[model samples]
Target: MLTRRTALLGATLALPAQAQERFPSRPVTLIVPGAPGGGGDFTARLLAEGLAGPLGQSVPVENRTGGSGNVAASFVARAAPDGYTLLLAYSGTHVANPALFRELAWHPIRSFAPVALLLTAPHVLVIRPDLPARDMAELAAYIRRNPGRVTYASSGVASIQHLGGAMLAQALGTEMVHVPYRGAGPAMSDIIAGRVDMIITTPPAVMGQIQTGAVRAIVQTGRARHPMLPNLPTTAEAGLPGFELEAWFGIYAPAGTPREAVLRLSRDIQGVTETAEFRRKAQEAGTYVTFLGPEELAAFTATELTRWSGIIQGLGIRLD
Candidate 1:
């Protein structure tokens, strides 16, 4: 008499559990919240190619660019909480946007499941060749003496580079004008043309100019020397101790996505990041793989979000 009820309940519970374990029976989409040909796209494409072999499904990259990646981020948050739709979220996704944007429907850490830290690229502080300062110490001293005479340009207002500049200025207890450019290209143009005093740009964006001797890379804002620019000293090495800023990229799933699914994705992402293909591609793009699994990535996000929030408020950065 009791057998019929117990059998059905057992079967019903086991079916979904089995399905969750199998995971990714269909093609998966890796959403890039930024334009193609950028660092975000590069990471997504590489991971998709690498993960396909292990997962036995095609992982395609779909670009959903807008609102500094908030468009794609929001799209993923509302997507089905399955393994099929994933996002290539960055430090910007979790940390920078919270303070930068005026109205975001979803909170970064609250809106997504932590997947893995794909990679990080350090920002390089570059100045026009004509400027007098030769290194970080000299640059800090010069800014202190000149006050607002020196202007630092960023890709745009509230961008990571801008924030880094603000943090740097704050740490040095100095003042420098902040010049907001529409994009990195324009910012670099002004730096090269001597229209702007300096800029902190990504390695790929500024490495060429530094090599060609158009702009001098005074120091990097990373904790250590970059493989691409080993000769250049980090800001800490250049006398601004504890000065480090990294443009980091990671993977995430919509919040409420099953824990098992997030684990599966995180494991596979770890596999992909460890592969030779990922390393080679990242190096070519002026990035390096620094994988952090779900727990670590989540904790890092929390710390970074707090860090960025304070920096934003202290500097009075705002979207509106």
Candidate 2:
């Protein structure tokens, strides 16, 4: 008889299937939680271009910079879980922020659906050329000699760079002053000018300085040596065993987004990442494109969250 209650129930039951079938009927927005030209923005734009062809819709990148990625993250977290809106999440937003902040507007793991891991860039430890520390061992000795006097710069408070430096100091059983900057440019400039003793950042940010001899590469925070800086040994090899920190970028949809939509996006993104052109582009940017589907990404995110939360809590880091 098609009563009102029955009609409502039928419509409600049909929504998931209908939404999945007509998913992304319009343009999709990939939110970047950083200023344009930054690593997150670049990764978002690259993925948007690659995804448009596969998704059959224009994927546009929207930059919503603030609160160390909190602004955009909160926006996406509160967005409808319909797959049209997505986030280009990184270690800062998901792993570090959850540990650093007491009250984040969104849950790093629970508020979003993991789609895929797009790329990873190993953090490099760069120091002023005149610091006199030729290797990690020498650097450790130097820090020990002048404990608590050395200053390390980071893009901002609670950033991945800050966490990396904090972790290194903890491992070395020494203390160093942390200097927060507005952005990486100013921080890198200070490091080059010898105002800051060192900075732990990604390769692309400091590769030019290292190449021009303006700064020295002490060690990388990766399990393996970075191909671009083959001469630089990893922290594990350079005395800090088992210390590895690599910044990763991945895609995420708001939680409750249909499973079909999540899987479809992950599959297409995996294809995009495998293309030769995309690989070359990512390499040239000092990042490597690697694909991990939804389940693997979820597992990876869980592990990272647990790992960084402990590190951050142990270091007593907080950001309101």
Show model 2 residue runs off by greater than 4 Å: 1-21, 182-186
- Model 2: per-residue lDDT, tens digit, 1-320? 89999999898888877544676688989998765545677788888888899999999999886687788899999998989999998786678898778888998789999999999998889999899899999999998888899999876678788888888889999999999775566788888999999998877677778889999999998888866778889888888888888898999999999998899899999999999988887887678887899999999999999988887888888887
Residue 152 C-alpha lDDT in model 2: 95
Candidate 1 Cα errors over 4 Å, as ranges: 1-22, 128-134, 137-151, 171-197, 212-215, 283-286
- Which 10 residues in a row give candidate 1 its minimum summed lDDT? 33-42
lDDT of 1 at 180: 74
Please write out the lDDT profile of model 1 over residues 153-176, one tens digit for every residue.
Answer: 875556676787888788888788
lDDT of 1: 0.81
Report RMSD for candidate 2. 4.3
